[model samples]
Target: MNTKPRQTGRGGPRGTKNLPPAPDNKENIDTQILRLEQLEQKFNVEGSNTLDIVYARQENDQHHATIQAQAAELERLKEIVASFHASEGALGPNITPSGSAAAGSTQDAPKKDKARKHSAAANVDDMALDERASKGQIGAESQPSGKKGKAPKPSAPTNVDDMAIDAPDGAAAVAGTGADDEGVSDTTAALARENAELKRLLAAAQAGPVGGPAEEGPAPGSIPRPKGSAGSDFNIQDAMGLGHGRKNRKNYKSIMRSCRDLVLQARIDWERPWAEVSAATKSKAFAVAEERHPILARFFNSWATEELMKQSVKNKRNRAYKHDGLEVPEKYAYLKANAAKRNPTAPRGRQAKLGRVDVARKRAEKKKKVATSSIKTKKDAKGKGKAVAPESDEDDVEMKQYAPSEEDESDCTY
Candidate 1:
């Protein structure tokens, strides 16, 4: 069979031409956002993404509502403009065309009163017609005069204190003239009452308790932050850090100190020495060692490790001093003495405790002791143990045997 490419329309998809044209970019973006929101709702992503999506949708809804309100207001304004235009068109000619005649006839005193009444009547008639048209009475007038709808008539206005009163212009004008000060006083009183209520509500919200007094609560937006709580404000960098599991850098020195204190406390509280109980209670806290709990084992192990590390460092430092042919510092003098004590042949005493400087002085003292012993021996030889000349054959033999050789005699003379 010969293979050939099947032709489709220029639109690229077979059934796409029948689909409604895609909206503008802004509308399409909104549609996509809505779809995404629905998807997010149906299959929620963990963490802050869900919260962000919700907040965005709420803001979008608020903006849309405000835009719709503004649009309705614009339409209402257009209708009012159209009504004003209609009224002006109907009344414009009557007012302007007769203006010059009225001015000239001002001298005709008798006709002036009639012209003024006609003008006043015309204005009243125009206002009445406008009001009737606005009130939807034009429909009533178009119906047959004899046929009236039996729809319930509007009841007379009530003068109850509970009901809000909407007085006509004449009534309102009369009230304003008669009780202007009273009206002003009432408005001020109402405003003051409203202000007090608002303050009370605000105080209650800040206080945290509904029944708590306003004075007891912290100032709004000024609540003291909880200790050890995470920060509220965050950024993209923080999100990245969280994704990778942010690390907390610890000061090992401080950690060692804290662990050491805890271990010491545990030992004291349990009334057992560290070495004796470490193996048995190593898996338990010192506080509750009898219970054999392992909660504090980690801390105990950390402290033990820190001690071992410290000993290792000390040994290394001592080795470094020896390698460099330098004397150990005074602080390490105790360690030097302790090591010497460990040897079986090492001498002990104040000299053992002495540092390198004192040990050198001790060597000089030993030399002086040898010189003093030699001086004592020479004095004893000259005074009490004097030599005698040989007289007998046996004495001569002894003399010959004990006497210094010729080489010793020469060395003695020197």
Candidate 2:
């Protein structure tokens, strides 16, 4: 049986009273059609609005469901993480998979690892079972795999906040102190460096350098040099010296004869200093009487010993033999000459540095000589009735080429 309304022959509902039949006139029919079209359009607009409301409500319900689902999932994840964290400390040291309260706390490493994993897995399963039980999905008393499945108690405190807020003044004061310390440290380092440099400079200034010996004169406490060419040192070459107004040895024959006479006089003894024999030591000692040649006579033992020593020094120095004035018939001249020059490369460059005191003494002596010569020139000028005024200091510096720079007047002892 249909629940739809029965239509009478008048084309209306049966529940209503007898209704009028619509007029069959063209105008009235046209009016009724237009009214029907208007009603249909109104119904269509109302249906469209109802459909829009239904769609909006459906979207809102879906959004709310999505939010609830996300909340549930977040709760689940939180529970898993909380259990994971809690299980680490909650599992007692005695827990194990085949638990009968476990044997002891000090178990093997592998056993501990297995126990840790099993306890964590059991805790996770217990959390899931409890969760399911609250939703009536699982029994609340459902047992996990192991008997000792409960979490252990944490050893540390449960409620302690690690991070804290610091006071602004305290932080700023600390920063300022750090900066001051840094600045002070830098200043101290700089001052220390400067102090070291100053100390070095002061020490250097106080202890001045020592002057070396001079280059122009002999050293003190040394033997007075022979007044002429290097005595007994015949291989004189490139002598960078002032020569001290000495002459070359031009006559050796007369010198030996003079030595003989001095030996006879018994004056040339070991007690006499070499400086006393000034007349004999000069390079050109022409004061020796050349009238009598060196006779082949027996000489004094002392004189002969002195001459032998001099000859030995000459031989050691590789001195060249001179066959000029002296006659040496005792030995072959050719043999002596060749023997002396055999080791031509024996002698080396001289390195005789003079002392500062000796150099100063020589300079004073030269000044004294210049003064004496100037006085003599003035006296001679006075005698000639002429004014002798030197044009310059250079003009007053007179030097004779071969002048004998006679030392203290000879006592004629030698």
Which candidate leads in TM-score? 1
Residue range with the least summed lDDT across 10 consecutive positions in model 2: 405-414
* TM per candidate: 0.18, 0.15
lDDT of each: 0.42, 0.40
Alpha-carbon shift of residue 320 in model 2 (angstroms): 99
RMSD of each: 34.3, 57.7
Error of 2 at 51 (Å): 2.7
Q: Residue by residue across 1-414, what tens digits does model 1's lDDT show?
A: 856555478836466667997566577446645865675766566343433444455668879997776666656655655664464355434333222223445356746533433332224334334444565653452333354675545433232221213433322221223343244334435545755665555454444334544565344433232323122232212321222322311223333333443344233222222344444334333333212223223432333333322333444444667796656657657666655545466433423333433545554566566567766676667866653332334433543443334433322210
lDDT of 2 at 232: 26
TM-score of 2: 0.15
Clashing pairs in 2: 90-151, 90-152, 91-152
Least lDDT summed over 10 consecutive residues: which range in candidate 1? Answer: 234-243
